[model samples]
Each structure stands twice: as C-alpha cells, then as structure tokens.
Target: MSDRQTSRAGMALALAFFSGMLSSSLPTPLYPVYISLYGFSASQIMAVFGVYAAGVLFALAFTAKVHIRTSLYTRPLYAGLTCVLLSSLLMMFADNFMILILGRFVTGLGSGILMAYINRSLIKLFDTEVSNTAALTASASLILGQAIGPLITGEIVHRGFYALKTPYIILFILVVMSIFGIWRSRLVINRHCTTVTIERKSVGAQSYRGLCFRDVIVCCMAIFLSWAMASTFISQGPTLARSYFNVASVQLVSYSLSAFLLVAGISQIVMRKKHHYSSLKIGVVAQLAAVLLALSSVHTKAPSLLFISVMLEGFAYGAILVGAATIVNMVARQSQQHHLINLLYIVGYVGNWLPFSLSVMMDHFTQETALNAYLILCSILSTCIFLSAYFAVRCQNITGRIRKN
Candidate 1:
C-alpha cells in the first residue's frame, strides 16, 4: 500500500476506536438524569457503572491468551461496534436500572475487546515509528471521545432534561457511521493484498514469567493509579458538583469532565519528549496536587478550585499513562509485548472499578464527606505510584552498575 493509503486507513480505524470509547462515557453527565428518571440510588447508579468495569474485566481475563491473527482484528472490531450499538439503543429506551446496567456492561465488553484488538492491529500494520504515531493518535482519540461525550451530552441534557435520549441518538448514528468506515477501510486494505503474518505465536516461557519482574509491576501499578483517578471524577463528579457546589447544571459537569481529558491529551503531546521516569514522577505529583485541591474544594465549596483540581488530574493521567506504556515497552520482550499490554489494561480497569465502589459511602456520610474520603484514597494511591517509580528507577540504575562491574 502507498504511504498515503496506509495513513488514511490508519485514520479510519482510529475514528472507529474513538467512537467506541466515546460511547463508553456518553453517560457521564446523564447519571443524575438516570437517578431522577429511574428513581435509582447513588449506590445503584454506581453499580451500573461498576457493571461496565466488570464487563471490561471479564473480557480482559478471558481473552488475554488469544492468538493474534491479521485477518482477525475486523471480527472483534465489528463485534464491539455491534455491542456498542445495542448498548446505545438499550440506554435510549431504558426504563429500569437492570436495562441500564446491561447496556453499560455490554458497552464495556465491546470496548474491552476492541481496545485489545486495535492495539495489536497497529503492530501488524506499521513499523515502530509509524505504530507509535498511530498509537498516540488512537490514545488521543479515545481521550477526545471521552471529553466530547460529556460536552455533547451536557448540552443535550441541559437544553431539555426530558430529552436525555438525544445524546444516545447522536451516538448511535456515529457508531453506525464508524462501523461503515471500518468496513470500507478493511476492504481497501484487502484490495491492496497486504497480508499480515504472525512470525511466532509466543515469545517464550521465560518471557511469560516476565510478568513477575519488578519494573513490570511498577508500570502496571502506574496504569492502575492513573486510570483510577480519572474514573473517580467521571463516576462521581456530577453528584458532587450538584451536592457540594450547587452547580447542578449538566453543562458544567460535562465541561469539567471534558477539560480533564483535553488537558491530559495536550499534556501527553507536549511532554512526549521527556524521559519516561521523569514524566511519571511529575505525573504522580500532579495527581497529589489534584487530591489536595479536591479536599480544599470540598471544604470551601469552590467550583473554580474543583475545576482546577480536575485539570490537574487530567495532566497527571496523561503523564502516567504515557510513561507507563513507554517504560513497559522498554523492558518487554518483543514477542511478549501484547501479553504485557493486556496485563496493564486488566490492572487499569480494576482501578476503574475501585472508585465506583466508593458509592457505599453515600449511605453513611454526606456526599461532600464521601468525596473527601475518595480524594484521600487517591492521594495515597498517587504517593504509592511515585514511590514505586522511584524505586524501580533506582533498581534499574543499580542493575546497570552491576552489569558494568
């Protein structure tokens, strides 16, 4: 295929990937609407969110060992897109909590599968430099979709509270278009007769045990901490905004969420040149600052401070995620890279699940108090991540010196 053709095909696949992620978060600003309309409690609302994480976990654990085949990416991609379409329809028509959970769970499952497929396909399609570019583009697309989901949904929901289905309708149409885009791109690639081959299926038994490596553990922890903080805001921010700041407007909720991802994406792009460990440390510090500001916001009930906290959280997310991926790639065996990445995401989604469990606090304490507790938890996790990275870097240096001696 020509360079231009490959780029275009890459962009098309990127869009499809973005569409799936966008649908995943399209409900961020609408959780309040669900509570009001479906008469669900905060805990139940969180359970619905948790179901999505559960679906992701289900996919990760079960599919981690699947062999990668070139002709296979489209199947999961198509299946995931279909699951997202079904999810949108169910959510649009949902009148009960059960249906809502089902919808979110299916969407999570779809996204989990697609997320794994797309990353592997990138390796099949491009060289290291080109694949890295495509990977960053896809990552940014995922963040952009997360940002756009709330912004668009916020506007729809705020304009007419009863019109909460508008965002799903829009998402449904986009999903359909994305599915078609993928189909067309696939046809184009096939027409070129560009065949993808898996030279070897497994790296080796030794690299399979590479999961026990200390640096790998630290990178996985980094992914978990980064995503855990991001999920906290998405799952609980709306309720906190309404209860604490009296800013119940869906638009503000959506915009704040959007700002978190937008800033994070930009941070990743701007700091792409920095050393991975340096970026990880700074990211951890930024997350700590976010938690501190969050505690202050809870006390002062300052919306601006809350917004600033979210922005800092975004910066931290971008840094830690990129840093973790880079560090893992540096240490991962070539043939075992896919397995290592799967492990990272499995841990990451577990981080996503933890914050949603915080909804139990709603029964015992005020929302502000519960949120303050959540921020404290995030602070502790951030500190652990920083220390882990510090020691991992130290170990890497000591090992290098030992080799020299």
Candidate 2:
C-alpha cells in the first residue's frame, strides 16, 4: 500500500478499533434509565455491571492465549462484533432482569476480546516495538469513546425516557456502525500487513514458578488500587447526583460523567509529554486530594463543588491509570504483556464492581452518610496505590513501559 493509502486505512482501522472498545461504556449513564424501565435495584445493577466484567474474565480465562498466538485478528474481531450486535438486539428485546445481564455480558465479552486484540495489534500495525504510543492510543480510545458514548447515549435515552424506545434505537444504530468499521478495517489491515511475533511468547518452561508470587502481588497493588478508586466514581457518582442535587436529568448525569472522563482523557495526553513524570508521587497525591475533595463535597452538598471535585479526582485517576498500565507493560515480558494487561483489567473491573455493590448494601444509610463512607474508603485504597507506585517505580530502571525484565 502507498503512504496515502496506508494512512487512509489506518484512520479507518482506528475508527473501528475505537468504536469497538468504546461501546462498552456507552451504557454507563444509561444504567439508571435501565433501572427506571425495568424497576431493578442497585444490587441488581451491580450484578448486571458485574456481568460485563465477568464476560471479560471468562474470555481471559479461556481465549486470551488462543487469540494472541493465532495472528488472525479479523476472526476474533468479527466474533466480538457479532457479540456486540447481539447485545443491542437483546437489549431491544429484553423485558426481564435475566436478559439485562445477558446483554451486559455479551457487551463485556466483546469489549474484553477487542481490547486485548487492539492493544496488541497496534504494535504490529505500525511495525513499531511496544511502547507508550500503543498504550496512549489504547487509553485514548477507551476514555474518549466512553466519554462520548454516555453523552450521546444519554441524549437518546433522555428523549426515550418520555417516548420509551429511543435508547434501544440509538444503541442498535451504534452497533451497526461499529460492525461496518470492523468489516472495513479487516480489509484495510490485511492489505498492508506487517506481521511480527511477540518475544515473550517464547519464554522457557517453569518460569512463572520463579516469579516471587508475593512480590508480584505486591507489585500489582498499585494497579488494583487505581481501579478501585476509578470504579467508585463510576458506580456511585450517579446515585450521589440523585441524592445531593435531586438530579432527574439523564443528560445531567451524562454531562457530569463526560466532564470527569474529559479530564481523565486529557490527563493521559498531558502525561504523555512528561518524560520524567513520577508515577508514585502523582498517584499518591492525586488520590489524597481526591479523598479530601470528596469528603468536602459530602459535607457541603454543593453540586458545583462536587462536580469540580470529581473532575479533579478524575484527572488524578486518569494519570494513575496510565502510569499503572505503563508499569504493567514495562514489567512484563512481551509475551506476558497481554497476560499482565488481562490481569490489570481484571483488578480494575473488580474495583469497579465490588465497591458499587457494597455501596448498594450501604444504601440503607442516609445518602449523604453513604457518600462520606465511600469517600473515606476510596482515599485509603488510593493511598495504597500511591505507596506501591512510590516504592516500586523509579527513574533508574523503570524509564518507561518497556521494562528490562
């Protein structure tokens, strides 16, 4: 392919990849809408959310190794796209709670598979070694798509809440557009193929036995902590909006989330330029600040203050995530890169699910008090992340994502 042709194809591939990864979070602001329509509880919402994570977990447990080694990205891409299509179909048809979980699970599985494939494939697409570009693109694709998805999805849902069919109709349209991108991308990439092998996949046997399980777990604490804090925002922010502001607007929820997500995405781009950004210090201070800001918002009960605080906290969270992902990529072998990424994603989703569910249990308390409790918990978890990044990451050895392991 000529340079001009390759550039055009690359843009198309990027669109498909971005579309696939993004649809996972398009429903983020719409969950409350779903609850209103289905008359489901928050715990039920957690279960439904958990199904998204679970779908990813199931794919990791079985398909991670198979897909990465095969060098055939299109087959999995098509399968994942099919799964996404099915999810929208199911949501349109679903009446009961079981079907809700089924839709989320399908969406989650597609997201999980697409994420692993796209992140890894980027390295191959440009004939470049694994570096922050792939990761930066990955982070951008996720945060931006998520940021935009809710804003767009919420608008459709806002309209549908009155008429009652717009949310499904919008999602159905998104899924179809996503499929077109995936199909066109497969053709684009194949024509300009620059196939390569991942080095880590060739590691000798019994190596995992030598990796100090205790230390590796310790090393991973930052990743998990980052997720826990991130999840708290996602799972509770809408509910808090309801309590403190009497927010009935789905668009309000969408706009608020879009603000936080915007800050988060912009932070990653900002960190990309800082060659010497401190992972440990940044992660630690940001979380500490987030906790204080959160605690204050509860006492004050000001939505403006709360929005500013969440945006600040979100900026910090975005930095921590990019840093943590960078660390994971740096620490693991090339072959192990996808595995470690899978693990990081798992921890992140676990953080995403558990606290929200726990908050549901705590929903019995007054909303203000419940908000306060989660703020304290999130602060502590964030502190743990800070401490790990501080101790484990340094300029000497961990210059960037490509570690010397």
Candidate 3:
C-alpha cells in the first residue's frame, strides 16, 4: 500500500475511534439532568454509569475468543460503529432510567470494541517509526473525543436547546459520518499479517509469571489507576464540584470535566517523546498533588484550587495512560498483544465501577466523608502504582543490560 493510502486509512480509523469514545462519554455532564428529569437518586445514576462499564467488559470478553482475518479488520470497526449508532438512537428518545442505562451500555460495547482494535490496526498500517505516532494519535483522539463530548452537550443544553435529545442526535450524525469515512477509505489491510486472535488465558495468575511479569503488572496497574481516576471524575466530579462551589450550572460542570480531559489529551501529545518511566513518575507525582488540592479545595471551598486540582488530575491521567500503553506494546508478544491489551482494559473498566461504591457510601455517610474516603483511597492506590512502576523500570533496565552482555 502507498503512503498516502496508509495515511488515509489511519485518519479514518482515528475518526472512528474518536467518535466511539465521544459517544461513550457524551452523557457525563447530563447525569444530574437525568436525575432531575426522571426523579431518580444519585445511586441509580451511578448504576447507569456502572452498567456502561459492564458492557465494555462484556464486549472485551466476547471479542477475546474470536479470530478474524487481517483483511477484514474493518469488520469490528463497522460492528462497533453500528452499536454506537444504536446507542445514540436509543438515547435520543429515552424518557426513563432503564432506557438511559441501556443506551449507555450499548455505547460501552461499541467503545470497548473500538478501543481493542484501533491501536492494533494503526500499528499494522504504519511502519515502526510511524507506529509510535499512530499510537499517540489514537490516544490523543480518545482523550479529545471524551473531552469534547460533554462540552458540546453541556453548551447546547445550557443554551435552552433540546437538553436531552440534541446531544444524541449529534452523536448519531457523527457516527454516521464516521461510517462513511471508513467505507470510503477502502482501507487496505496489511496482508503480511497473520490472523488476529486474542488468546484466552487467566490474565491475573498465570499470565504474570515470566521475567517481564513485573513490567506487565506495573503497566496494568498504571492503566487501572489512571482510568479509575478518570472514571470517578466522569461519574461524580460534576456533582462534587457543585457541592464544593455551591453552584448548580451544568455548563460549569461540563467545562470543568472537559478542561480535565482536554489537558490530558494535550499532555499525551506533549509527553509523547519522553521515556515511559519518566512519564509514569511525573504522572504519579501529579496525581498525588491533585488529590491534595482536591482535599484542600473541599475544605476551603476554593473554586480556583478545585480547577487546578482538575487540571493536575488530567495531566496524571494522560501521562499514566501513555506510559502504560507504551510499556504494554513493548512487552507483549505479537500473538499475545491483543490478549494483554484486553486484560489491561478489563482491569481499567473494573476500576470504572469502583467509584460507584462511593455513591453507595454516600447513602450511609456524609458526602464529605465519602469524598475523603475516595480521595484517600486514590492516594493509596497512586502510591502503589508508583512503586510498581519503579520496580518495572528497574526490571526492564536489568533485562536490557543482560541482553546486551
């Protein structure tokens, strides 16, 4: 395939990836809106969010057992896009909690499939030097799409537009456009590649028993922590922000969440050339600082401090995500690449639901108490992640020296 053709295919893939991620998070800022409209409790809304993560895990598990020809790479992409479209369609007319939950779950299914396939597809389409760039592109597109989705919806809803229906309509349209782009590109699949299959293995016990096991564990932990932090913010940050600032504007909440994700996206691009270890170190520190700021902001009711906290959280999220993904790419064998990536995501999505427990805690405890518990939990996890990363880097350096000798 020609360079131009490859570039076009990569672009098409990125668009699809971005669209799928955007659709998955499009409802973040609208959770409060749903509560008000449907008269549901916060725990129920959190359940809706948890259901989406469940869908993602289900898709990952289901896809892990199938083998597809390399030439038909677009098949998963098409299947994912169709699921996303269905999600939007369901959300557009959703008037009750169950429908919203169903919509979010379908969107999760689409996102999981796209996330599993997009990076691998990009790697196949580009040479080694360009493959790194492709990976960065995929990561940035994912973060940016997530960032923009809520911003767009929040703005539209704030402007007295069709608060509930307009965002999904736009999402539906975007998914359709993404489908067209993929169809039109006629993506030339890499024929030299063998069948793409995800090996079925116990990712926890058996899979982590080699020389590179420590590195794999660290990478998995990093992704899990990073995504867990991001999901907590997506699922509850808006309401928390409102409580801290004593305001109730959806746009404000959306803007704050978008800012967090936008900075995360930009940080990924800026730190793309750095060593994965350095990125992980920086991310660990930033995450700790962000948690400190969040604790302070909550106590002092300082909006500025809260926004700063949000930005730091975003940086931590992006840096950790990129570092973990790079490490996984380096350590995973070609045949086991899909399996490892799926494992990473499965861990991360499970973390996605960790915050749901906080909502349940709020039922029994004060919001402040729940918030403190959650932040403290995050701090503890962040420390563990840092230790894991430190040892992983040490292991890798030792292995490299042994290889050279």
lDDT of 1 at 56: 75
Candidate 2 displacement at residue 15 in angstroms: 2.9
* Clashing pairs in model 1, backbone N/Cα/C closer than 3 A: none
Candidate with top lDDT is 3
Give the Cα lDDT of each candidate.
0.73, 0.63, 0.76
Among these predictions, the greatest TM-score belongs to 3
TM-score of each: 0.81, 0.77, 0.86
lDDT of 2 by residue, 1-405 (tens): 466654554555455556665667666666777678779897898688678888887875556567344347667767776787788777667778898889889888877777666655554454433345655666677777666766666667656663234555665676577667656656545544343344324432121222222223443565565566666667666766786667778568757776787888888887765431354347557767867777887787767777777777677767766655554444444345456666666666666654755467465887767767777776676677556555544333343333435
RMSD for each model, in Å, please?
5.1, 5.7, 5.3
lDDT of 3 by residue, 229-346 (tens): 7887776777777775775786777667777888898788877877666776788778878878877877787888878888898998888777666656545543354556667778
The candidate with the higher lDDT, 1 or 2, is: 1
**What would the TM-score be for candidate 1 when compared with the true structure?**
0.81
* lDDT score, candidate 2, position 319: 73
Flag regions of model 2 displaced more than 4 Å. Answer: 1-13, 28-46, 127-131, 161-220, 241-254, 276-284, 299-305, 330-337, 357-373, 395-405
Runs in model 1 lying further than 4 Å from the true structure: 34-44, 129-131, 161-165, 187-213, 241-254, 293-306, 329-333, 356-358, 365-376, 398-405
Give the C-alpha miss distance for residue 209 in model 2, angstroms.
23
Candidate 2: clashing pairs of residues: 200-335, 330-401
lDDT of 1 by residue, 1-405 (tens): 677766776777777778878887788778888888778997898788778878877776666777645565677778878988999899899889889989999988877877776655554455342124534655677788877876788678778855668888888898888788778778543342232223222322222222236776887877787788788787678877887689969777876787788889998886567766667778877877888898898889899998998999899888877766655543433445566766777898778777755777876888877777877887787788778877767776666566557
